[model samples]
Target: MTLIDLTPAPAATARANALPVAIIGAGPIGLAAAARLTERDIPFVVLEKGESAGAAIREWGHTRLFSPWEHLVDDAAVRLLGASGWQAPAAGRAPSGRELVDEYVAPLSAHPAIAPHLRTGVEVLAVTREGMDRTRTAGRSRAPFALRLRLADGTIVDETASAVIDASGTWGQANPLGSGGLAPLGWDAVADRVAPALPDVLGADRERFAGRHTTVVGAGHSAANTLIALASLARDEPGTRVTWLIRNAAAARISTGGDELEGRGALGARLERLVADGRVEVLDRFEILRAEPAGDGVRLHGRRAGEAAAHDTDLVVAATGFRPDLGMLRELRLELDDIVEAPRRLAPLIDPNVHSCGTVSPHGYRELAHPEQGFFIVGMKSYGRAPTFLLKTGYEQVRSVVAWLAGDAASAGRVELTLPATGVCSTSAGGCC
Candidate 1:
């Protein structure tokens, strides 16, 4: 697995420092990191598998964000875009994912300072140290990082960098619908019957789910948001039914709000009321074990109260949240939490059992570092399987990381941001952060 030969520390640092920093993904976080590097005059390259920036978010553009534009926009990006006459959107108005790309991501990516360094349709297949595999230890810390890239034209190439910042998000790697953290029986054949999280049920996907029964499997914000949209669709389209599935004995996770639109999160409260009013059906303690195609629909087989239970539905929405695709980092040295899969030091703070998207305290490079030198995983990928990442938090992360890379320890250690103390979004339409 080794490529370039290893060298001594002083010589390796001198040679590696001359190489550009490599950033994976061109999403908001990746581009923000690029902006920070650009502001510091540090040479960097951004590689995105998508042909355009924010490609993943574009898939769910119909969903509206709860956070205002002020929180979505990165300070370093703002400074760079502002100089190019790019005016910020009104601070208080929340934007849909499409609007976010149009009003922010596109402009930032097109900025004179960043456009040249942005490489679209470039996918990074793997990341490891030059002349080193996961087993090699001596002088591994001093070797430059090697990246295997798949280009737009299907050509493979090798690239190296002084530092690697993985802002590649987890939006593409949604978790399975099975109960035991793996795909259910017959998943391979009936996979098409399953839908991703936050499907545009009211708009783009109205035809597919209009009069069909959908079994939504999950207890997170994405599940609640999809339920709201399906409920709304049912109002206009007859025969539209939603079956809420959960492994827990009770649906306590979605009943956060106290029967009223409180000061904090309210999405859960709306969902609770809907369930109470019989607008949606609940199937708690149902652990899905198998799924098979039954006619044009799908048959979900699971256990309820230790007994066999099965349900036939036209579609299944697996809003089970996402997990970081760490397959590419097989040769890297990483210390991640056993449960959440987040960086070890950051796991406790962002773990779902203890922290919420808005409550996770502001942290920086130190919390994101790996045993492999100059490698940091930022953005939603930093949270691993936990669905508790905010865009602003990603911005602050890169700010600290870039500062540390630039030899500014003081700025890297300082916490300059504060987050809202609430949990999930206040509106049902607001999906994951």
Candidate 2:
């Protein structure tokens, strides 16, 4: 890594210096930023749109993560949690989303140093420089950021911050089912037939998939996890038909066999065997074009290998991956890659079309920054449309960004991270859809 020492910035305007740094989202990465700022004795605020912290992860809490406990817990958060007599889960135990939040996120949010700065049930409508839009440039770096927010009670208010780190993940912005990356025709009318990316099959959502013809779409781990669950459901419930679809010629690259991510490798291996046993139907090179009503179910119109095709199913688990919500940041000037929508410098490292390594190179604030000074996109959202994010990557992101904000340039610029035994696989370059 090149040594780019970001020495302590002399100082900023009085207004900018007095304001606290604003960190968006209260998930693992956002909260980790808070802890890092606290360690630096810097004031900060965390805004969350959900009712509580880690709201996005809680939505898919039933699904187990491919990485284990050690990789999930952020170092700064551990420092805070450890002081309160918190016990760490076994290093090798891969936990479900629920366990991740309950064991690590919940306790970190409740920590006194961090809790006072966190505000849940609030939404950030837009972000821009005070008294200026993206077009204005004079003195932009000196001006504090103006955040337009809607309160839980629907009241609108404006907040200001010296710097902003958007750790708000991409889970809420699910990719559409269309082959062209847009929602298929008649999508809104037939939205009720689609299940979430990670439906609680064999649990809360079992009744929806049991004894029904359910089709799982996409070619990522999200699809694999749902397929495995639905396959299990078929065993106990007769007449439960399962079908898997992918845009590629073959169904593969769910996960790679490696020494590091055992849980993920196991998932890919099991899914392959399940498909071989003829328990789940495989549809490759299938492109969805539209949707229409089919009695009580829905018929998806598409093309299979340039020929028209159709499939009717009672339920559909899109599992089509996610994308960052760029609409709210329109007022802020951003330098994004045209294709992936990530920071231009970071896009090349994570672009699945260009990068095929087992893992990405270590990166920090320098790679995460945009043209808008003092603003950054961190965590999974930083990867833009790429689906190669891991919890440890986000941890490193906030750590460096917060250090730079605290005027510790050396720590911010000195990026050192490695995801052992892993590399990029057949991930979708088009937002993992």
Candidate 3:
């Protein structure tokens, strides 16, 4: 790894004179904040729990973003990367998550302006107000915040900052799978008898699934991905049979960059193709009730949509989505939404009237319309219930907040670009749809 230290030549005494700003999470949003701070000449340090920029993106790096490159990349990010002579992907192309991290995020991190201040693998466990301490700024003394951080190596460090922003994204929580994400007869009954978790990508546990029938549930992107991956495996593993259960009569398509899946979007299209080949059993609008060990496999009891009678199946999977985990914030004195437990509102400008020192709203987009003060939340963790548009929203929020921090009120507002209205999938044939 190349390390370039850009700290001023002045002694440590002089270096500690500047006010600090704490930014958590180094995804696209955090990079935006760093870029804005660089342009404004603000002295700040960014803390990222991940090993590098967009670590979350790296986890699903093989997948494609639902939005086009234009929506994924922000203006501030483009400016920084441009200074280093980096060319961006074509405007409307949907890049894979890995591509977004590499071409867009990595270059921004290498920028001299933002690079020096970013400390990777540093997770912020908590942020609290420090008592007043007068410090000379220009000619008078001013108060600044004292930040507390817990690094990945279990090191605890404290520093002073004037502001804080959160770009942690939705990677923090898991959406509930309904009924504890297991068939009602109890998963333990079939736990030793079924395939392993995420088996499509990881490969089924042959001892448990060979010559066995299985069922999967849900209608979201993740569910689609798992089903498609499994279908491909079935081509060679003929002894395995698979069934897909959807609560809705039809699955919704996940669209991006003029692409659409025939069954819905790309995933829906893939599933449709799988169905055509007799590779999967499609049970639309089926609600599961229970499951139990029945001879060789498990018996899953559920009612089909509009059907008064119950039905049976061999194995079941819960593919429902996730929600924000408020366990960490339980001690903080902040308002939460009744339904999702996310912050209620956030202002673009950091005014004390809008938010307290340590909180963020659940719906991050709302923060663009009404800014929050002191506390800022970025990345997917801030997206709460809606993660489909997380990348676009996170990019905008950081740009707006950093601009306001630099005292540029004109920069805060709704994004001007219109999201692509094309079908969820197209002839372009992007994978991980």
Candidate 1: where are CA atoms >4 Å away? 1-11, 258-264, 420-433
Q: What RMSD does model 3 have?
A: 9.5
TM-score of candidate 3 on Cα atoms, chains taken together:
0.70
Error of 3 at 30 (Å): 1.8
State how far residue 245 of model 2 sits from its true place (Å): 1.3
TM-score of each: 0.93, 0.94, 0.70
**In model 2, which runs have C-alpha deviations exceeding 4 angstroms?**
1-11, 256-260, 354-358, 421-433
Q: Model 2 clash pairs?
A: 6-409, 357-423, 357-424, 358-422, 358-423, 359-423
Q: Over the stretch 41-135, how does candidate 1's per-residue lDDT look in tens digits?
A: 89999999999998887887877776777878899999999887889999777788899989999999999888999999999999999989989
Top candidate when judged by lDDT against the true structure: 1
Model 1 lowest lDDT segment of ten: 1-10
lDDT of 3 by residue, 3-122 (tens): 212111212223333666678778777888888777788788888888898786676565555556765677777887887788888986777667887888888877888888889988
Candidate-wise lDDT, in order: 0.83, 0.82, 0.56
For each candidate, C-alpha RMSD in Å?
3.8, 3.3, 9.5
Q: How accurate is candidate 2 locally (lDDT)?
A: 0.82
